[model samples]
Target: MNTIKTIAARAFLISAGAIFYINPAWALLPIQHWTEPSGAQVYLVESPVIPMVDVQIDFDAGSRRDPAGQSGLASAVANMASKGVMAAGGDAALHENALGEAWADLGASFEANADRDALHYTLRSLTDPALLDKAARLAARQIGEPSWPADVWPRDRARWAASLKEADTRPGTVAAHAFAAAVYGSHPYGARTTEETLQRIGVADMQAFHQRHIAACRAKVSIVGAVTRAQAQTLVATLLARLPASADCATPLPPVGEISALTAPAEQDIPFASAQAHVLIGQPGFARRDPDFIALLVGNHILGGGGFVSRLTNEVREKRGLSYSVYSYFAAGLHAGAFTVGLQTRPDQAREAVQVSRDVIARFVAEGPTEAELRAAKDNLIGGFALRIDSNKKLLGNVANIAWNDLPLTYLDDWTKKVEALTVADVRAAMARKLQPGRMVTVVVGGQR
Candidate 1:
């Protein structure tokens, strides 16, 4: 009987192509949302097609919230969360080893990531009742009671410091660091890890940060897969209840101020030994909830985000062969983000490449996308939308973002319609309003000084 069940599962998966592909025009699966009694926001999508579950929990505790002079504190703490935690007052290393064995036995995958605005913890496990329970318990402990093992701190901190030092040597890294610093002077967004800052980090610091920032009030939990509403409610409650109900000790992160309008274009060049020059351009862009976001999204596809079909690629790469690739995007955050165009070119052609890229952008901003380009972008976006949410894991990521950004529940449902309604005029007008070529910052690494 067991062998028959296993064969049936494999056959079903093979026939169904692993995931049920939804038509781009269909409404996205409904998200069941509620707040746990512990104050964590919960979003769920019941998917019974596969006997698996994915859970992602996010906290507003990213590097942006790190204290002054503590550049890498948040990242270090996030990394250490999985190393070892005090569970049941036993040896931390032994506890972590056992937990690892348990996950291996249950075929669970776990990960933690920290970015500028949030820290994310994710778990994927089979929905077998016993297996699910163990995975959830392990995740809860990692979230609520990080042990911050004394012995593990030195090794983790050293590894992080070494990685940062290595990254600083790369020209692309140099350009990115210089660009972010120039764009966000004195803001926490400009924070970068250094040997000095890493030295200041310690296990105690991580413990304190965890206490203050990893509270239920700051959490947004997203769950997807084979689970009932009652099961989801119980699971989330069990997980989040381990965390503090409120941020009693956290110093609130200040809102990022608007970028001041540039009177003239800002330029920076860092000499490096390389055959190709790495270049970056543009200025501050809209927040996540900016009304012009959809228009800008559609327009950027024409400008550069649409791969070989983009204007930047057509002019810079295909037309003149100045570079192999060039692209632009808006890195929207909780606060004002950046719009950037980036590329690499032969050292001697760096100046010309920047000029051509800027010219392409200026033209696009002045006239917007052509009717054909607008239509192509919308069609491509709408057509590819289904792949974005075709799997349980992918859908969980989208649901998490929606919950974190406080977007309307209908955001996913309305995505295609929004893109479809955008006109050439809308794209042109939005680009002209949001992007200013004259005020942009330019950074080049690895060309003549």
Candidate 2:
């Protein structure tokens, strides 16, 4: 019976060609749309096999909304929401009891990422109808009405401050923070939370941020899992009805202009540490909606983007043995995000490592991938595409990304075809247009250069 099922599934796939990575028979369905009474945009997807459901509600309440002096308010608001709610009892017991009743994992965890235009609050859970009810109630109440539990503020703030101080002591952290500031300049994207920022994060600030940003007006809900259409509708409705009306909810996402070259020199003397130092060089790259995404994606694979076979890894690690690992990648965002090249090596070899990495990037940008590299990159990318979309978890993540970026629904279906369609000229054009080594922000931490 199992063998028959396997053969049938494979046969179905073969006949269905390439409509979907799984269940080719399952037609490409539009993202079911419905507006909640409260006006939150709801997106529902049905996959009724695992007898479970995953629910997500996001708000434009990202850290970008943090006021000038209060850089951590959005994070604090998100954190406090789940810790307590207006459930069976007050917030503390509400959280404790919810955990006792069923599994509750923090999708956003305790981390805070604030961009200039938006903030995000996300949660996921298994589908037990009863648990679903409780979760919706809890999530809605938290987003709609949150009161910071006493004493939690000072404790969490202390921990946050301590972590920031500790992160300052590490080379990698130093490089990342410095890179953001260097690349963004006076933009809010470059804002960093210091001890002063943390100290100024009052409970009133969190309340104010939550009221303004976590309102129903900015909500976008997505659910994809083992949920029936009826169940999906109910789930979305439950979430939507709990949010506020969409008024004045539009958050601004402005473009980041070209950033100046930046260099930050810092030293952390760690006793009894390895004599090696770490280096990171980067600059702002393309936005999520850039037309050259496919070209850059394929081209980067041949450059320092891919692991063992990347140009940077080959030149720095394999050829010169300057480091054990080196690589580069472009992080696409709402705005031009980051194009970062990273590596670790001995202090004495730091300068050589930085030079080689920069040279590789420059060459790739000037000439793009050779024909052979481009072909391999396309073939590898297209062939591996299925493996990337083969699971529910991966598909869910893809859908979230699509909705987040407002990508067309047909993106996944035509992605491989688009990648394979690129010519070497396309790659060269993309590389030249995207990567600028001289304008890059470079940071070398540890060991004397």
The candidate maximizing lDDT is 1
Q: Over the stretch 382-428, how does candidate 2's per-residue lDDT look in tens digits?
A: 77776665545566656666667777767776787799889999999
Q: Which is the leading candidate under TM-score?
A: 1
Per-model TM against the reference: 0.92, 0.83
Taking every candidate in turn, the Cα RMSD to the unseen true structure, in Å, is 3.3, 7.0
Candidate 2, run of 10 with poorest lDDT: 103-112
lDDT of 1 by residue, 1-449 (tens): 35434544554464356455433332467888988766678988887767778999998888888888999888887887777656453524335676677566656777788898898999887776766776777777787777777887888778878988999889999999999887777767778889889899888898898887788767799998889999998888767656766566356545655655456789998899988999999887877887788999999999999999999999999999999999999998886678899999988999999999999999999988888898999889999988888777788888888898888888889888999999988888888888999889999999765
lDDT (Cα, 0-100) at 241 in candidate 1: 56
Model 1, poorest ten-residue lDDT window?
A: 18-27
| Displacement of the residue 134 alpha carbon in candidate 2, Å | 3.0
Which whole-number lDDT from 0 to 100 does residue 56 have in model 1?
Answer: 94
Which residue runs does candidate 2 get wrong by more than 4 Å? 1-30, 33-37, 87-118, 244-274
Which pairs clash (backbone N, Cα, C closer than 3 Å) in model 1? none
